[model samples]
Each structure stands twice: as C-alpha cells, then as structure tokens.
Target: MRLIACIIAVCFANLLYAQTAKEIVQKADEKMRGKTMQAEMIIKTIRLTWSREMQCKTWMKGNNLAMIFIVAPAKDKGIAFLKRKKEVWNWMPALERTIKLPPSMMSQSWMGTDFTNDDLVKESSVVEDYNHTIAGDTIIQNRECYIIQMIPKPEAAVVWSKVIVCIDKKDFLELHSRFYDEDGKLINTMNSYDIKMMHDRIIPTRFEMIPADKKGQKTEMIYKNIQYNKPIDDGFFSTEKIKTLN
Candidate 1:
C-alpha cells in the first residue's frame, strides 16, 4: 500500500507540473502576439558569399490569421502571403495567380530565408499541439528563465520531434529555442534579442534563426514598427483580399 501511494503521488505531481509549463508557454505566446497586431519588419538572409534583404508589412489576428505583403525590393514587390486557419496561400503579381501551399511545403524555407513557412504563418499551435513539461531553469541575457520541453502529441502535424525553450520569468519572453528532428538531431536554433518596449508591451525586437549544420548562414528579422491590439477585419486575410493588394 505504501508503494501504491508513492506512485499515485508522483503521477499527480507530474500532471501538475505539465499544466504549469503549458501555462508558461501560453503566457509567453500571448505576450508576443496580442489579440491583433500590425507591424512592419525587415528580414535579412545572410550567407558567407551573399546576403539578401526584404521588407514587408504584417497583420496578425489571434493565432488563426496572418498576412504579409512585401513592399520593398522592386523585383519582388507585390508578392504577398496569407494564412487563414489551416490554409496558406501565396500571391504572385508576375504570375497573376494565387498558389495554395500544401502541408509538405510548410517545412521549406520562406523567401529563401532560414525560417520555414510554418514559422512565419504559425500553422501549428505550440501550446495545443505539444505536451509541455518543466525541463529546468537557466539565465539568458541576464534574465532568469524557465526551461520548458515540448514534445509533439501523437495527433499533431508539427515538424519538430522535440523543442526545448527558455522563457523569461519576469516578462515571459521566449529567449531561445532549440528544435530537434525525428532522429533527435538538432536542426535549428532560434535566439531572441534586442529587448525593448513596443507599444504597451516589453518584448524582443530582433529574432535570429540559425541552421545547426550550416555555416555562416542565418536569418535575422527585426521589427521596425508595431501596434498591438489593433482592430483588423477578418476579410483582410482572405484569398480574394490578398489578390486585391497587388
């Protein structure tokens, strides 16, 4: 009977810790993405030999909708991408057609950058699709953080086999995350830096995604301007609406 009691206590403690870890992740996600947001950003894809830059305006509503319109780079102007719920579409002005992105394409690099399409559009929910557990603690950039480990649920369609993230304790910022593949090989690392006050929230203004095996190649995304909790209509993220932007 003593052994049975100990087993039950351990199970209960694990369940409680899981809930706490999930809540931490949810809070950090909410801090980054408010109810609605409009922002302008610049992305630089750097390689040892060459580098490319692109500028765009972005709108995001909750976790279900997001749209980006490329406004710079004369040759790539008028290109846009929209994500509505589980579907993603890309609009090309030169081709004059909208391409629906399939699940297989989500893992591909976005606009030749280190970030994947899923990273930009957020097709899968980090909170909903993964089981969270408190891994440990660490300090990043002088800020104390809670290290959380996330494993994909059996039914989830996420790409990473395992994700370990460090969340700032005070502000709930995601300071860093390491992504592993199915074979438990480290695939990429994302580091968030340049913390500042954007509108009413304190967050990271610059994010860098670096490939694990690649050398001298990384993508940097920096926010130029952002407004949180703005009012944006749902119609703005539709396929028909994206085409009209061109």
Candidate 2:
C-alpha cells in the first residue's frame, strides 16, 4: 500500500509540473527563432491568373528588428523594407522615397500578395502580447502537436482577434495556424512544412499562407538558407542600410 501511494504521489506531482500554453509558445518561438538570424529566401505568390517568384536576403535581430533586401527580378531589385518594433518603412529605389507604413495600412496586402503588411513587419509579439490556452492536442503530419489558442490582450496592438497555433511536440516547430476575426470568423490559415536541417536545427523551411475565403490563391516563402544566433548590430536595421543593401 505504501509503494502504491508513493507512485501515485509522484505521478500527480509530475502532472502539476507540466508546461502551460504560454510556456509552450515561448519554447517553440525560441527554438525556431534564436536571438538573431540571417537568411536568404524566396517568396512565391501563386494566383489564378499568374505566379511569380522573388528572392531576398533577410536579417532579423530578436523579435523586433528585421530588414529584407530584394535581390532578384530586375523589377524588384534594390527594394528593401526595414521593420523596427511597431514601425515599418519601405525603400523604393526607383522613386528614391522611404515611405513609412501608416496604421491604416497595417492590415493591407503586402506587396500585392496574400500576406498582410503586418506579416512582414512582425509587429506582434506572441510571448508578450497574447493570452494563450492549450485548447487540445492532435497529430499533424504524423507528429503529435499541441493546439494552442492565443487571444490578444486588451492593450496589445494586434490585428488578429484570435490565433490558433499547432506546435509539433517533438521538434517544437509551428506546424499550422488559423487566424480569426473579431466576429469569430476565420480569416486565413498558415502552414509550415518541408522540415530541413538548417544551421544545426530542424525547421520548416517552407511557409504557406492561404486565405479562408479565397481559393486558387496562396503565398509561400521558402527559406534557402538560414544562420541562427549570428552577430548583427542594430545599425543593420537602419533605413539607410535598407536602401543601400544589395
């Protein structure tokens, strides 16, 4: 009887020590995005009318600072975007103008694609701005995953009303996400796949964004290479650097 009681006590204690939804999100975010990251990737937009691909190099420092410099397709070459915290700016080399994104444009399409401007700017901080609850668990792509629902805090300046995220249990990689509107209607879905060994870590190199209301249209980003935890100074995220980067 004493042995059985001890075993039961240990099991209950272990259950109490399990991770919560917020902790799971933080762990997944840290595993995927280290302190800093530099990557070269291609963006592909597929629509009913046309399909186009553009290549760019991206540098991200923490969750707030990032810059992308387009390098391909003569039309978009030399264009860059700089994101610092809540602010975002676009450098248009052809026009020689650095346009700052206004608040109203935050939810608009990014570069005429399915992705929103907020997606590139990354103004939302999941760990800091959300109230997360582990709604359930399921298998995604033959791997166990925790389905976590995150609602924006009252003071969080986020566009999504709610976000349901699926994180793989083994790798902590984000497998899928569903964004909803304030009225409790589905807005769009994002999925990550094509797991690869990049820079000593397993990650989903391919990200696809599909609108819940639109068919035959989607936007995807394929990461060709990424180096995590690289040394990058704050100056790299400056507007001048955005215009000058090749």
Candidate 3:
C-alpha cells in the first residue's frame, strides 16, 4: 500500500511540474502581446568595425505581427519595417518609397550587423511556429530558469531551425536564446540583461545579439521610455506615418 501511494505522489508531482512550465510560457507570451517598446540600439558590424547608434520604436500585436519605426540622427530617421504574417516591407523616408523584402533576403545580415534581417524583425509565433520541449531547470545570473528548446515546426516559415531559450522561473521572462540554422549550424546568440522598471513592470533593458562566426560583431539595444498597455492609434502603424515620422 505504501509503494502504491508513493508512486501516485510522484506521478502527480510530474503533472504539476509540466503545468507550471506551460503556465510560465503563457504568461511570458501575454506580457509581450499588444505592446510597444522604444529603445536606442547600437549596431556593430564585423565588416565595418564601427558601431552606429539609432533610436527606434517597435510595436507588436497578437502573435507573429510587429512593426519597427526608426527615429534617430539625421541619416536613418523615419525608416520603418513592417512585418505581418510572413511578409515584410521597408519604408524609406529619404526616397519616400516602400519596398517589399524578398524572402531570400531574410537570411542576409541586417545593416551589416551579425544579426540577420529575420532576427531583427522576428514575427514567428512561439506556440504555432515551434515545437517546445522542456530542457530541465538551470540557474542563469542567479535566477532560476527553465531551459526550453524550441525547434521550428515542419511548416514554420522561420529562418532559424532551432532556438533554445532560458526563461526565468519567477517572471517567465526570456533571459537568453541561442539560434541555429537549418544545417544545424550555430548562428547567433541573444541575451536579455540589465533588468529595469518600466511602466510599473520589471523588464530587460539591455538586449544583446552576438554572432557565432564573427568574433567582434555584436549589437546591443537599450530600451527607454517604455510604456505598456497604453492607447496607440492605428494610424501610427500606417505607411503614412513612416513617411512623416522624420
């Protein structure tokens, strides 16, 4: 009788642990939904050996939909990138032209930086686009984390074949991610650090992207003036705003 009781307890514990992981992911996803973030990004490219700083704002709604608007120094002001479904469009303020991004260009380096264009504007849904598996528990920067492995689904339209994320157990925030290519080659790694308070919520203030092949090329983004769940007009996301934002 005692053996049977012990077996039941172990099974129940396993079930509860699985439920916790799912809940963590769901909460993290909810925090990112229908939100906008403003930040200053410093892009470092191995080819150029010089870093360029640009100020930008990103808006995301639902899943797999996001738009980024650039507002910065004289050169790159008023540029915007719209990512919806599997398509992407670039609006250039200087030329006053809207250009569709080709599918092949998704894998190209972004702005000569280590990150690919797809990495810069990630639009894949975590639930539908990838298969998630728990990789057990680990500690990252003193925070208890659940290491999850995410592999692109067979029908997913994503550039990376696999991604591994370290999710904080307490807050469900993604602390780090490692991206791999279709050929199973390591591509780049992304880390979210420097936690700060914004809009009454604690969030990562610094995001870093580093390439596997390029030793010196990395891009760091520092978020500031972040407002969450605030009213945002639809017109702010329209192509007209891209042209006038400069």
Candidate 4:
C-alpha cells in the first residue's frame, strides 16, 4: 500500500508540473498577442557577404486568422499572405495569381529569410498542438525565466520535433526559444529583446532568428509600430481581400 501511495503522489506531482507549464505558456502567449493586433515591421536577412531588408504590414485576429503584406522593395512589394484557420494562401503581385500553400510547403523559408512559412502562417498553435512540460528554470538577458519544453502532438502537422521556450517569470515574456528538427538536431534559436510598452501592452519589440548551421547569418524582425485590439473585420483575412490589399 505504501508503494502504491508513493506512485500516486509522483503522478500527481507530474500532472501539476504539466498544468503549470501550459498555464505559463498560455499567459505568456496572451500577453504578447491580444485579441487583435496590427503592426508595421522590418525584416532584415543578414549574411557574411551581403544583407537584404524588407518592410511589411501584418495583422492578426485571434489564433486562426493572420495576414501579411510586403510594403517595401520595388520588386517584392505588394506580395501578401493570408491564413484563415488551417488554410494558407499567397498572393503574387508579379504573377497576378493566388497560390494555396500546402502542408508540404510549410517548412520552406519565407521571403528568402530564416523564418519558415509556418512561422508566419501559424497553422499549428503551440498551446493547442503541443504537449508542454516544465523542463527547468534559467536566466536570459538578466531575466529569470521558466524553461518549458514542447513536443508536437502525434496528430499535429508541425515542422519542429521539439521546442524549448524560456518565459520571463515576472512579465511572462518569451525571452528565447530553441527549435529542434526531427533527428533531435538544433535547427534554430530565436531571441527576443528590446522589451517596452507598445501602446497598451508591453512586449518584445525586436526578434532575431539565427540558424544553427549558418554562421553569421540571421534574420532580424523589428516592430516599427504596433496597435493592439484594434477593430479588424474578419473579411480582411480572406484570399480575395489579400489580393487587393494596398
């Protein structure tokens, strides 16, 4: 009877840890993303030889809807991407056509940058599609953080095999994340910094995604302007709307 009691206690403790981890992640995610958000941002792809930069405007309505419009660089301008629930589409201004992105294309790079198509489309949600566990705690950028491990659920069509995120304990800010490939190889590391108040909410204004194998190559995204919970119509996320976005 004593052995059985010990086993039950251990299982209960594990359950508690899992729940706490999920809650921490949920809060952190919500803090960063309000009900609706729009931002103008710049993405710079840096390499040892040369670098390229592009500006874009982005909108998000809940977890299921998102849109991005490339606003700079004469050649790439007016390209747009829309995500409505599980479906993703790309609008090419040059081709004058709309392409529906399949699950196979989710792993590809976005706009010749370190960020994957999945990163922007967000077809798989971290909170809903992965199992979260409390791995440990650490400090990042002088902030105490709770390290959470995420493994994709069997039914989820996610690109990463494993993801570890560090959330600041006080503000619930996501300070850093490490993404691993299927063979348990580290693929990328994302760091968030320049935390400040963006209108009504506080968030990390700058993000950098560095590929593990690429030396002196990384993509930096900096938010130029942001507004949270602004009224956005659901129709704005449609493929028809994306093609016509100016």
Query: Which has the better lDDT: candidate 1, or candidate 3?
Result: 1
lDDT against the true structure, each candidate: 0.94, 0.88, 0.73, 0.93
**The candidate that achieves the highest lDDT relative to the unseen native structure:** 1
lDDT of 3 at 24: 66
lDDT of 2: 0.88
The digit string of per-residue lDDT tens for model 2 on 165-218 reads: 999988899999998888999988999999989997999999999998889999
**How well is each residue in 1-246 modelled by candidate 1, as lDDT tens digits?**
999999999999999999999999999999999999899999999999999999998899999999999988999888999998889999998999999999889888999999999999888899999999999999999999999999999998888899999999999999999999899999899999999999999999999999999999999999999999989988878988887774
Write one digit per residue (lDDT tens) for candidate 4, span 123-220. Answer: 87889999999999999989999999999999999999999999999999999999999999999999998999998978999999999999999999
Worst 10 residues of 3 by lDDT: 38-47
- Which order, best to worst by TM-score? 4, 1, 2, 3
The TM-score of predicted model 3 comes to 0.83
* Clash statistics: count for each candidate: 0, 0, 0, 0
Pairs that clash in candidate 1: none
Rate residue 153 of model 3 by lDDT: 75
TM-score of each: 0.98, 0.90, 0.83, 0.98
